[model samples]
Target: MKKYIAIVGSNSKKSTNRQLLEYMQHRYVNDVEIEIVEVAGLPIFKKTRDMAIPEQSKAMATKIDGADGVIIATPEYDHSIPAILSSALAWLSYGIHPLLDKPVLITGASFGSLGASRAQAQLRQILDSPEIKARVMPSSEFLLSHSLQAFNTDGLLIDAEQTKWLDSLVKDFAEFIDISAQLNHTHQEDDTRMADFSWDEGTTDKEVSK
Candidate 1:
């Protein structure tokens, strides 16, 4: 089964972003394994000195690296992605580049009219950086504006139009993951083939150990 990790990009217990991710987890758990993760356990990122990563951050990186794709649901904080989300990304960008070539989907819920569009846009730009190289789902932005009033008594999204839109985004994301994985696999195979002969001469012991 294809597994996807959903990240709640907030530290607040009352975060609506976490609520939105929980709804998604409940809705899609049966179809695909969905794990909602948070970054509260991780220490703030420091680039100056600490080379050794924390245990919690390592575990988080492993989960993200093993997943077929990732979904980040964040609440807009000052028209940008939350600070916690940025800290988590900084950790992931440290060693093995866990996000490299992985499929990612960015979404959010907000009380304002624009939803979290600005935040998601900033997130997409960061994810597309040459260092990260993540393949973000580009079909449409799933911004749940006025999100507090967007749900019904049954805990389901009340807007039929937005519901359909989200469903389409999920489907497209799945397809994108499949295709991206195949291409990455092909590239890795080619790299392995080319690295097999005369590849030892240019490598340091540390590189060879990996």
Candidate 2:
């Protein structure tokens, strides 16, 4: 089966972060299927809420669980990711915990000089929890700035230099995903062998006693 990837961002409309994600999707072509997770309809997370989560939140969690890797892009608000992203993260921290040990690549774009540095930094901290073993790319290599003019009307990256850099980033992430999948496969094999060995040992001991 083809590995699935999920891309998420804070905006619901024509957002620069969304544009960057679309650009990345295009680069992958048929190698992998990329699904964009919509966070717009998620209700603000509240622990004391009497109502169940919105359907959108459930859908987002399903997508994250099914994806081989997740990519997050966002705009900086008050030197951090928007509350919308935070709320989504909090909501996904419930049962199943799909984000735990998941491969994640984070990037962002903005009109400010710091690019989405502050927001990315905050997100890195959030993902640093013991439950989440994320492979966050280095800060200098992942942040994209001055996004207002960086993309074309069709959401394609037009700058040759920037495109090259973005391509490199995506390639690196693809390699990381490949390695992670291999490790998971190996771990599963080891687990299966261990289970079989235990069963065999039990059978041999029973035969010896008989």
TM-score, every prediction: 0.84, 0.77
Deviation in angstroms for 110 in model 1?
A: 0.8
Candidate 1: residue 171 lDDT (0-100): 80
Please list all clashing residue pairs in model 2, or write none if there are none. Answer: none
Q: What would you estimate as the lDDT of candidate 2? A: 0.69
lDDT by residue (1-210, candidate 2, tens digit) is 235455555755877887777777777766667776767867776543233566677777688777877888878988989888888877666332566656788888888777798898889888765434455655433677888888877877777887887778777777777776655644445434433432123345445344
lDDT for every model?
0.79, 0.69
RMSD of each: 6.1, 11.2
lDDT of 2 at 202: 38
Candidate 1 residue runs with Cα over 4 Å from true position: 48-50, 185-210
* 65-183: candidate 1 lDDT, tens digit per residue: 89999999978879998888888887776654677778898889998999899999899998887556678878567899998898877778888898888888888888888888677
